[model samples]
Target chain A: MLSFTFWDILSNLLLAARWTVLLSLIAFVCGGVVGLLVLLARVSRSAVLRKLSGYYIEAFQGTPLLMQLFLIFFGLPLVGIEVTAWLAAVLALTLFTSAFLAEIWRGCVEAVPRGQWEASESLGMTYFEQMRHVVLPQALRISIPPTVGFSVQVIKGTALTSIIGFVEVTRAGTMITNATFQPFLVYGLVALIYFVLCFPLSFYAKRLERRLHVAR
Target chain B: MAYSFDFSAVFDYSDVLLQGILMTVQLTAVGTVFGVGLGIVGAAVMTSRSRILRVIVSAYVELIRNTPFLVQLFFIFFGLPALGFRLSAWEAASLAMVINLGAYSTEIIRAGIEATPKGQIEAGLSLGMNRVQVFRHIIISPAMQRIWPALSSQIVIVMLGSAVCSQIAAEELTYAANFIQSRNFRAFESYFVTTILYLALAIALRFVLKMVGNHMFKRRSHA
Candidate 1:
């Protein structure tokens, strides 16, 4: 049996970490776009749109993300779409991220004070105009910390994609563990790598939150 | 593409689904009780005067918070055996859930504790209460009242996260889904049904938490 050195494991895991980073960026960006649209529908003028988006958020948020990924990984083939782990992971994470980010941003938008909305409306601005010129800008300011924080969740969420055979950090750790039979060391390193990636973001988010509080 | 949908294949294993759901519920219930208990202790340590303990708690919180739950679960399930602690899948899953939720609720509860007005603690102390008494009477109840909703939401999230326990063969709801799908080859229908069940379970769990929070915290407002 060939043995893996610690360097081999670490270097290999780092290589796979790049995919984790890439997958996270893709999901976050795509999810942000989709989330914005869902946010519009969620807070739209029409009751049907609002209710539909509400269910959309509920469905995504209420279920475990693993189940969602399972459905995407297993369900897509029946509909004749060629399924790769990449496609399934991206699709599932995007939908999951969109639902959550929309909900979080909705809270931020609602927190923008009723008077601001009223003032914008009294200026005879259309709903979209009010949203575009007034509400979104204010919401966007307070939304930054939470949005950045949610990206940590996005990164963590990508770990689940490893189960779907995506060759990211977690999958790499599993593969290396199989080869090295050092699950304790490999998994510990995996956890440490994630902590390294996520702690700075969490710390920054907290710092930003504090600054916002102090500013207000 | 026209594919005939067959949910009947999945329904044939209703007993397995029920067993899986029961296991999931059992895991969640244990995790919630002990996890929140651990969080309370962790938060207490966090808000305590001991610097070393506080640092330790903070480190624990950050470590668990930043890492994926899947990794934590895997580490406990797969790694601990090498360290001479051979745990069953159920034990590892529940332990991981407790630890995971403990870290999250530590931060959540600490936020509530920090928000407690200093004057109230002084007042409790002035009435001859010790630190533990102050924590129990003057601090914890009101803090819990304030953060009950957040804590409840965290509990529900942990419950949903318990789905990952299936990976280690803990036989949770998702495990049932996987089993049914494997047997019937109805992956879509099985997962679809299981996802809906999760949705329903989430809603029910939220309702239950709301009721419990109301019952527990009702006296706090009057006191």
Candidate 2:
């Protein structure tokens, strides 16, 4: 059996942290796109789209992301669509992020005041034009803070993907502890890595929020 | 190959699933109670004039909030034993959940505290109310009223996060799912059943929490 030193363990876990960062970026970007589409449908003039997207958000929101990950990782194989852990993780997390981002973005959009919507309509602009030119520009400014805040969530969420067998930092921590027989030091480092990744975003999000609050 | 779905194996594990659900409910209930209590105290401490206490509370909130809950759980369960404290999986899970929930609800409740108008607190003070009286009567309850929805959502998120406790073999709902899958080799079917149960639990929890919030805060209605 090979005995691992603190530096060796830290260096190995540090390498694994890259995957965590990559997975979070992939999930956040993909989820952001899906969430925008959901936001559009959720706020559109068509009642059917509105209702369907509403349920879509609810179904994702009302379930645990752990369960979603299991279903995607385990359930898809049963249906003859075998997915790698990476693929399944991204799919489940993207849907999860879409739901939350859609909800948050919709709140910002609605906060643009009802008069903006009516004004855009009265200007005879198409629905897409209204959103592209008017609604999103204003809403995007308001959306930045919460959206950045949610990125912290997406980063934390990548930790759960480790359960399905993708070796992110937390999974790497477990494997290292088993090897080194030092759970305290290993898991503490794992947590510190996550803190390093997440705290700056949280602090910036708070600053943005306060700036917005002061502006309002 | 067209796969015909079979759920018979899942049904065979129904009793196990029920026990898992019971344990989950117990863990979540206890975690929420203690977590919210910590949140209340933490929020107060976060806002107090004692600069050291304030910095300590803020550091706790930032550190916990930034890290993943699973790592936190592993630290409590595995790390503590090395430091001369051995905890049962249940004890470790509960403590981790409580601490995690506490850090979160601290921020949420602190927001509510900050949102309390200065006029309201001043009014209480001018009306011959002491600090404690004004805090209890004029500040805390109203702040809770303002932040109830956020607090409720955080509570539910922690409930869902409890699913991770099964990793440490805490016998929660996900643990049951894992157990059934191991027995029947029906991973898909078992997880499907467990997923629906989780969805149902989340919905039921949200409803129950909302009702409790409504009942408690109804009399404080501004109108």
List the per-model TM-score of the A chain.
0.98, 0.97
Please provide, for model 1 over A1-216, each residue's C-alpha lDDT reduced to its tens digit, 9 standing for 90 to 100. Answer: 787889999999999999999999999999999999999999899999999999999999999999999999999899888799999999999999999999999999999999999999999999999999999999999999999999999999999999889999999999999888999999999999999999999999999999999999
TM-score of 1: 0.99
Q: Report clash pairs, candidate 2.
A: none
Please list the C-alpha lDDT of all candidates, in the order they appear.
0.95, 0.93
**Candidate 1 local Cα displacement, residue A195, angstroms:** 0.8
lDDT of 2 by residue, B1-223 (tens): 8877789989998999999999999999999999999999999998788999999999999999999899999999999899999999999999998999999999999999998889999999999999889889988998999999999889888988999999999999999999999999888899889988888998999999999999999987864
Q: What is candidate 2's CA lDDT for residue B69? A: 92
- DockQ for every model comes to 0.89, 0.85
The positional error of residue A156 in candidate 2, measured at the CA in angstroms, is 0.6
Tell me model 2's lDDT, rounded to 2 decimals.
Answer: 0.93
User: Model 1, B1-223: lDDT tens per residue?
Assistant: 5889998888899999999999999999999999999999999999989999999999999999999999999999889999999999999999999999999999999999999999999999999999999999889999999999999999999999999889899999999999998988899999999999999999999999999988998876676
Candidate 2 lDDT, A1-216, residue by residue in tens: 778888999999999999999999999999999999999999998999999999999888877889999989988888789799999989999999999999999999999988998899899999899999999999999999999999999999999999999998999999999888899899999999999999999999999998998998
